[model samples]
Target: MAFFGFKDIDKLSEVDMAIYRYIVDHDEQVPYMRVRDLATGAHASNSSVMRFIHKIGYSSFPEFKVSFQTENQDLKNSNDDILTMFTRDAFPNDIEKTIKLVAHLMLDADNIIFIGMGASGAIAEYASRQAASLGFNCYAMKDPYYPLVQQLHNTSNNVLVTLSVSGKTIELVEMLNNFVNSADTVLTSITGNIESPIARIGRYALSYNVEETRIHKYYDLTSQVPAVYLVDGLLKELHNQDVARRIN
Candidate 1:
């Protein structure tokens, strides 16, 4: 379910994540495939595939396949109520802590940039408006190609909040990669898959687990409600902290 609940998900390179996602998404076909076949399917070199396999704690390809199959055997398909997918306890332990920490980052930030593509872009826009209403300098970049310098504040801390259901969206990932090394910018990501590439790169990563669904195999119908909740949660926490500081 989570790359077999792998402990070193944070260590996976982007290429390794591609292979991991490919295998998970095409679970039925992977157990029978050779290393070369997996490389072809995941659009990576055989060496990359092997690296990922070993990273997940397998000594050999066959051993990895056997473990993967055992882990996936209990996976069952089910339709989930999008509304109830997130509950009070939905936040994982790490995310619960990150939410508290990120609130401080937002409170101190000179700029808060919300980035996303497609459906997530809509949510990013919504979050920006909400954050702006709280008097934070926030901008939503719906288009991945938008020049960040247009609204960037170079004099102070900048927080980049990325929203994605599948954290593997190429455009968003590439954009994050460009800013990953900036000392003035802080990276935060809200994704359905906490182990996704974007999540791994974020200084703060929050995740809400939900079954990924698609219509016509092209349109991702993954629920954005959890993402909305996380945005509101972060904003609410930020508000509380700001109010407390004012009162103090």
Candidate 2:
């Protein structure tokens, strides 16, 4: 039921709802069932069915099947038994603050790098592309295996923008715990926990306000989109600043 609240959400359509239900209902059976069987049984077409699975959180139908069957194999577990807090209305303040801090960081930084994994990784990639387009020294590292701690320990100049909805990503935490208080390096974190290891260690922290819906594991973004919104706003702010400097 982790993805339940999202089932009938305006954000997701009927087919999406059906697909999620099917996954949950046949949690054990899905891993052995063929896509053709799922499509036929679910009364959905195979192509669209496959796409929907990926959209919900699976990389492919096979992965989705394995994840479904292996729910018992999860390493980390959630504490909240009943969903709460994050919904589509997680508040706008978190995102808004992200915009302001990011712009300021860019104006002050020699370079910027955004790092993340999972949905946060997607966000980092989005921000990196935007920053690069604006001519900022921004990169979103795909090397999740390498400890960001070692990288931060060796690098100089600029800023590091990291994303973690839970604010508990291990590699990222390593980086923050290692560097945060030692040198006055700039770090901006977008996460759910204001007091998480990474956020606590950051020079500036932006928490994505998430509302826990009845059935979804992810919190609603009233707090999260701010990181993305901040990237857009920072670009605009820099544009205005450049124009003003030229006029002056």
Candidate 3:
């Protein structure tokens, strides 16, 4: 429930960032951290802390505390962990841990082959660039048919991040069936509904808990928007990993 190391919040100046971090870490304590209380704890004038809060996009300490707590209200298992951001949840503390694994696998792979189909193939390409900037070699397997085989043959030190929202792509399922499991590692980002065949094939499936399937007027899969959040979580984990490596 605490801030995810406040990466976005840290972009602000040091003083403003400190206050955001404090509110995030001690939201429950803030019902008590009044102007007088902040003055004592931060050893800065109440005016200074109040000013810092607004600079970082909060109206006042009380309002900020309320917003923080509300955002983090459901502390335990959300029925749909994929729909809810699990790292922000309290149940599986391993959400961040899993994300870190994904980022690390992407970063450390000598030759990473990402297998994805349909819209997820675009997601794979975008993720490839994100990892490349971090100094990892990534190749997004473009076509669901042949490109995957070619890409796989090119790289043995591979991490296959196969993405399927339905987890029922026939070719993807078949590929998962015939492909010799790579010795390196395999990660999946799929809506792990129990009946999903793709979920059954994946080594480690990153569950994207999409809430409901509705016939939108445009017929678009709006639920997949949460895939962006999964990518964001993965990037945060990578950033944390980079910070830890530098600190060590």
lDDT of each: 0.86, 0.67, 0.63
Sort the predicted structures by TM-score, highest score first: 1, 3, 2
Per-candidate RMSD, Å: 19.4, 13.9, 11.5
The residue-level lDDT of candidate 2 at 122 comes to 82
lDDT of 3 by residue, 1-248 (tens): 23333345545666655555565666577655677776556556787787876765677677866665665565533444655443344224465666766677655667766667767787878877886777667767757667465545655556667777777778877776655466645645545353588766655556655544547553435455656567667766776787787899
lDDT of 2 by residue, 148-181 (tens): 5565566566677778767777877765565566
Q: Score every model by TM-score.
A: 0.64, 0.53, 0.54
Error of 3 at 91 (Å): 9.5
Candidate 2 vs candidate 3, lDDT winner: 2
RMSD of model 1, in Å?
A: 19.4
Most accurate candidate by TM-score = 1
Of models 1 and 3, which has the larger lDDT?
1
Model 1 Cα lDDT, one tens digit per residue, 1-248: 24568877788889988998999889999989999999999999999999888778788999888878776775533324424666766668676677889999999899898999999999999999999999999889988877674446355599999999999999888878877888888999999888999999998888888779999999998878889988998999999999999999
Instruction: For candidate 3, list the clashing residue pairs, or say none.
Output: 82-209, 83-209
